[model samples]
Target: MSSAPALADDCRFDDRAGLLAMSPEAFDNGPDEGWDALAERAGCQLEIAELFTAYRQQAKAAGHAGLAWHEATMRADAGQRDPAIALMRLTYKPHGADPEGWNHYVDATIAFLDDDLPALKRARARLAKLPMPLGNAREQGDDERPAGRPQLKIVDALIRCMYQPYALASESCPEP
Candidate 1:
C-alpha cells in the first residue's frame, strides 16, 4: 500500500552494472521461495517497453523458445493484437509436440485476439477432440492438467467468460 508502485507507472529497470553483476543469482523470490517475486528494490530505475521486447528477442535467439511465447502474450495484453498474432504465427510452432492440440490452441489464441469467437470456438472444438498430453511438457505436478491441453481450458474459459481480457475474467476463467 502506502509504498506500492503503480502498475501503470512504467516497466522500469536500471543499475545495469548491478543487475549484470548479480546475473541469475540475484532474482527476487516470494516468501514461498518457490516463485520468482519481481524486483521491487530501487536505487536507479528506468522504464521503457522497448527493452522488454528486445530482451525477449535476444533470449529467444539464444534458444529460450518460451520467453518468446511470453513476449507474444505481452504484446497481446498491450492490445497490440496484430503484432502478437504475427509473432505467434512465425514461431517454431506447435508442429512438434501434440501438433493437433497445440496448433489448434494457436489458432484459438489468434482468434481470441481477433475477436473471432466463431473461429475460436472451432479451434477449441478441435483441441477438445485431440488426445490430451500427460502434462505440459515443461513442468508438472499441481499444475498438471488432468483433462486436456491447458490451452484448451483457457480457450474454453475465455468462451465461458465471453472472452473478456484474461485478467478481467481469470477469477471466473482461472488460468491465463
Candidate 2:
C-alpha cells in the first residue's frame, strides 16, 4: 500500500468509471485482472469479495468450476492464503473433461500463493511440456493463441508476481 499499483500502461485507479461500466460478462471473461486490481487499489475488494463469494456459491451449486477459483484468487490477493487454498481444494473439483495443463495451472496458482516456489516451478514445467489439447480440449483463447504451448504466459506472470504482493503484481503483470 505504499503507492497505488498501476496497469502495464500506467492506468491507475483514480476513479472507477470504466471498471464500473463493465458488464458482468466482461468481468468473468477478462483474462486480465485490471478491474480487480484497480478495485483493490481503490479499496474495493471488500465489496468485490462479497460478490465473488456469492457467485462462487451459485457456481458450485450449479456444478460449474471457474467461479470458485475466482473467489480463491480474490482471497489470495487479500492474503487469506489458508482459506484460499482450502476453498480451492473444496469447491473447484477438476473434471475429466478438463485439459491436462489446466490441472497443473491450478497447482501452480495455489503453490504460487502458498509461497512454494519449487512446487510452482514444477507445475509450470509440467504445464509447459503439455501437448496441445488434441481436438476440442482448447480453452477459450486457444483458437487465437499461436501454435505452441498454451497458458505459459499466466505461469510466468505468477512468477513475476512473486516480486511483490499478488494484489499489486496482478495489475502490473504484462503477460496477462
Judged by lDDT, which candidate is best?
Answer: 2
- Compared with the true structure, what per-residue lDDT tens digits does model 1 show for residues 44-155? 1112223335554433245445434545655565556787787677554545655546678778888877878899899888888876455545446554435446676677
Off by over 4 Å in 2: 1-41, 58-61, 91-96, 134-150, 174-176
lDDT of 2 at 96: 60
- Candidate 1 has a TM-score of 0.62
Q: Which is the leading candidate under TM-score?
A: 2
**TM-score per model over all chains:** 0.62, 0.62
Per-residue lDDT, model 1, residue 71, is 51
Candidate 2 is scored at a TM of: 0.62
Find the 10 residues in a row with the least total lDDT in model 2.
1-10
lDDT of each: 0.52, 0.61
How much lDDT does candidate 1 score?
Answer: 0.52
